[model samples]
Target: MGALETMMPPPKRARLNGVEIGYYEAGPREGVPIVLSHGFPELAFSWRHQIKALGDAGRWVIAPDQRGYGLSGKPGKVPDYDIDHLTGDMAALLDHLGVEKAVFCGHDWGGLVVWQMPLIHPGRVAGVIGLNTPFMPRGPSDPIAGMRARFGPDMYIVWFQNPDEPEAVLGADTTWTMDFFMRKPAAAPADPPPSASGSTFAFRDLLKMWDPSSDARERLLSPDELAVFADAFRDGGFFGPVSWYRNFTRNWERSATLPGRIDGIPCLMITAELDAVLPPSAAEHMPAFIGDLETKLVKGSGHWTQQEKPDEVNRLMLDWLDRRFPK
Candidate 1:
């Protein structure tokens, strides 16, 4: 077993909302618990490093695989993966664990979900931490139209709205899929990443767009660690995770009624200096909506900030956590 497998807490399961949630819990039952939500193509295993550190500091840490990933249940319908169900899963997890509220920290798509907990279920959130993803208030129009206009139809998010194709591309070659995603960017990309560099690469079109061996990006996981994802995904398949993108329109329609601004809660925004998809600038306007917000930048880091710079992310989290809520 790798350090990750050895250090990771034993897995636990609970029937939450409409699915069985696979989670890992540590530290004491007391204190305001911290729930970790992971992003696309990742599992609670992504938070393995933070889990032990935060738990050892006497903070209750809960990391769930979320629906459709890892040991968690994957419902058949695409609508089942909507924002309401995604956020509802965590709220249900809290009830299962017998906790009232928790400091929800999420990264990637998970970041998007944690940002909503306070709005959808206002009473169940103690604090909010958005890693790489910033708090995005609803735009005047449906985000899908904008995303399609901005990123083009072939863009991963927009393309995912189509059934079978996206997941088919991913599930066809599981090994290459994991390797394509779980890597540290080269100081700069050998080619641009759909940035304003006058170049466009549709990440969803992985088969033709980017090749695994063509670049020098570093591996974020060991062979053993990589297998954990490869094997689980081999069994779990990619539909559940990819279906999350399919809910863009439904999520928008439902969220139209939730409170737009977040106030009266401690929120932290951690930005990655090199995360082009969600750069520091994306979070600049966050203060306009979040009454009490603190921002930190992880230097020379990419999208996988927590795993890429675990020590720095942990320090920033612990320092702010200690000051805001005592254990």
Candidate 2:
């Protein structure tokens, strides 16, 4: 029906990690396997461009709708969405596909999963590549506590810990929510630093604080492309998606035993130059945590780096793969 629909198509379901995962697969069955993971409020559909590019270039690409998005199974409890369970979904997907190990690429929340997978399940990961989000090591405190101390109660992530409230607010108008988040952020407002006020600005107020006129939603997606996300969110609702944030503390506690550093894995971190939520500066401390990390800055791109600059992201991924996991 649309270019994305034609290129990426619908997903086939696979039972992995005790949940039914909706995934799209392409390329030769024997080709080098690569798993592409999408971020919050996103589906495998977000990876349409990379799926086609990698598939055509002779890769067995598998893009799953993760645990609680798209056509996948939606677990009820917030604890179910913790990092261990999230990484298990990917590990189980490989087992279901008869793959011992595969190159894993993730964006946003997906990036968080890939970064932790190498630390938790080393043997199952061949390499890790992150888009926008970087590998952040856990500090002495629980992540949610740290976030609360840094961003206060109104922060989108902090607000999400309440569960039902956020789900209701976000699901009330899925279309607007989708359009609002998918749009480019407005200029960085002059705000108090985290240390200055004991809490940085609240991103939960983005929809209300930023000017609607500045949003690039109309330019980024056609009604058809937007519908793909809006429709799925409408059906699945935001409960499962928001549940991901609710597990910040659980993930931190579970990962306490993991070594403070992630080594032995070839890692790539791509920074979206204009991404307000996770800017290029976020990766400054990455080298300390990731031993073999390689970094790239996607010029003129925002949070949706792969979707906004598909060719550049794809070329960078392909070249990195050729060098690290060569044929």
Candidate 3:
């Protein structure tokens, strides 16, 4: 733990756009609004440290659990979870807060949402900040086609987009899935590799490979921290979060309607160096889509940069926000 961790207060929930979005807010109510969006398989608690740090800087920060994760309203229908619904839910949250425009920040899938927000509702965004994920320009063909071309047969996207299969594969073992996503990297392989693409292991087994030493494991997340995540997932299940991957084609079709360049919006992108899923290479051509962009690479971090390195993440975000909206 660090200074940022000590200052974090528990989160509160609110009913926004028919969904009870679990959110954490800090600083004065009348301060400049900064909306923080969480990624898949995560909650607004992911921004716990950020909420405290940025709030102390005299900025109003609101981190929402979005529609489908945590205590938020998790609708049953697949169509209800589309990109339009996701982005619209966010816009409605802003409306509920009586905010005309706010600094929008996102991570992972949330990054994808914020990237499209300026294009979809240019009027609602004052500035943009993306963590881990980046913008990829869509061409004449489908977006997944390019990803498939790059990653080949074993790609997670292919499995995730299958609709029926992932709900079973992922949902069957929610604990393992959560551990696989949160586990840190390892120095060596513990056992011989499995033959098949889907040969599975227990979540704890996979985590052990990351670091055999119990002390190292303890440092990453205490039992209490792990319990916090487990309780949320155990209660919510994995269907809603996994459904995010199933929306790729829908997003592409909707995004196809937007123009090539979106001007006048200030953008900031922070790349996680160790992010295996959305590598830094994906961001190579981002400038082609965004008009004014500022990018940074957060070294020694992975997909969960905000949780992994809160201080560095907060410093970059606060500096960028201050520069965009000076005192």
What C-alpha lDDT does candidate 3 achieve relative to the native structure?
0.74
| Top-lDDT structure, candidate number | 1
lDDT of 2 by residue, 1-327 (tens): 864567685679988888999999988887459999999889999999998898899878899998889989999887789888899999999999998898899999999898888888889988999999998888788877777876787777888888488888777777777787775444442342343234555545554454557554435666787888888999998888889888888888887789788888798999988887788998999998888989999888878888889999999999999899886
Off by over 4 Å in 2: 2-4, 185-204, 208-218
Give model 2 RMSD, 1 decimal. Answer: 2.8
Go through the candidates in order and give each one's C-alpha lDDT: 0.88, 0.83, 0.74
| Best of the two (1, 3) by TM-score | 1
Q: After superposition, how far is residue 149 of candidate 2 from its true place, in Å?
A: 2.1
- Score residue 183 of candidate 1 by CA lDDT: 85
- Report, for all candidates in order, the number of backbone clashes: 0, 0, 0
Output the better candidate (2/3) by TM-score.
2
TM-scores for all candidates: the values are: 0.95, 0.92, 0.85
Report how far residue 111 has shifted in candidate 2, in Å.
0.5
- lDDT tens string, model 3, 57-140? 988888887787887888877767778888887788888888988888999989888877887778898988989888756677
Candidates sorted on lDDT, descending: 1, 2, 3
Candidate 3 at residue 322, lDDT? 84
Model 3's TM-score against the true structure: 0.85
**Positional deviation of residue 45's Cα in model 3 after best superposition, in angstroms:** 1.1
Q: What lDDT does candidate 1 reach at residue 326?
A: 77
